[model samples]
Target: MSEQATTPQDLADDAVVLDVREQDEWDAGHAPGAVHIPLAEVPARIDELPDAEPLPVICRSGGRSGRAVQWLSAQGYDVVNVEGGMKAWEQGGKSVVSTGDKAPEVL
Candidate 1:
């Protein structure tokens, strides 16, 4: 069955947002308080993922995060994919940040 997907605005204040994009993509910009774990590394680092409610996974777009959600859910995670991903999050004016003063943006 397809899992539920939610927009940035719909996420709860305490939700855990997981970014499954590549390292460079994550370095560019990501949602504030989001966790960065590349899709390729998820299997090996699955234990690092938060055991929390409304675990929304995201990427540049929804594709990669969607796949990650599928795998994580199968592994017994209470996860969901962020519909439209970071692009939508940025477009929706949600908070995003990078390591430095550079303006945050999706790569």
Candidate 2:
């Protein structure tokens, strides 16, 4: 299956942002409104994702998310790999949500 790539801007418009990082990484910081499902758990947690549109997968440096895109796309789910991941999101002047007791918006 062919997989698409998405930019942070595209993600902001209309897409479900999936953070494939581990719990610790997610707790440290993550994109605001992003869904946290570590790569290790995605196979079992696939049902948690919506079935309507493509979802963008993100990781710290794009590695894990790329793998996720590959895996999910193979499973027939519309998935996009967010190039450059969270680092790019921050570099692109996008917003992130810190995962503390409650996720807080970070400028």
Candidate 3:
């Protein structure tokens, strides 16, 4: 299958952002408005994922999210991998939120 990747800037304002990182990683930081669904729980929680084109999946660096994009694509969910993942998102100065009062930082 062909690869589909997008940068933080390319995403639509109302895009469905799926963060596939672990629980702790998500607590540390994540794109504002993005959904928190860790990679391991994806299969079981597949129904929760939006049935939209170009669903954006992100991880700490991109490996896990890339794998998810592949699987999701095969399942007919037009998914895309967030290149460079949260690291790139942060470097791009994109807005991120955290559960804690402290400023969100990619972990």
- In order of appearance, the predictions have TM-scores of 0.90, 0.83, 0.90
How would the candidate models be sorted by lDDT, starting from the highest?
3, 1, 2
Better of 2 and 3 by lDDT: 3
Give the winner by TM-score: 1 or 2: 1
Q: Write out the backbone clash pairs for model 3.
A: none
Top model by lDDT, which number? 3
After superposition, candidate 1 runs with Cα above 4 Å error: 1-3, 12-15
Question: Model 2 lDDT vs. the true structure?
Answer: 0.78
Q: Compared with the true structure, what per-residue lDDT tens digits does model 1 show for residues 2-104?
A: 5557777887533578989998788889887788889999999998887667688999889999999889888888888888888988888787788677887
Model 3 score (lDDT) = 0.85
For residues 66-100, write the lDDT of model 3, one tens digit per residue: 99998988888888898988898888878878888
In model 1, pairs of residues that clash are none
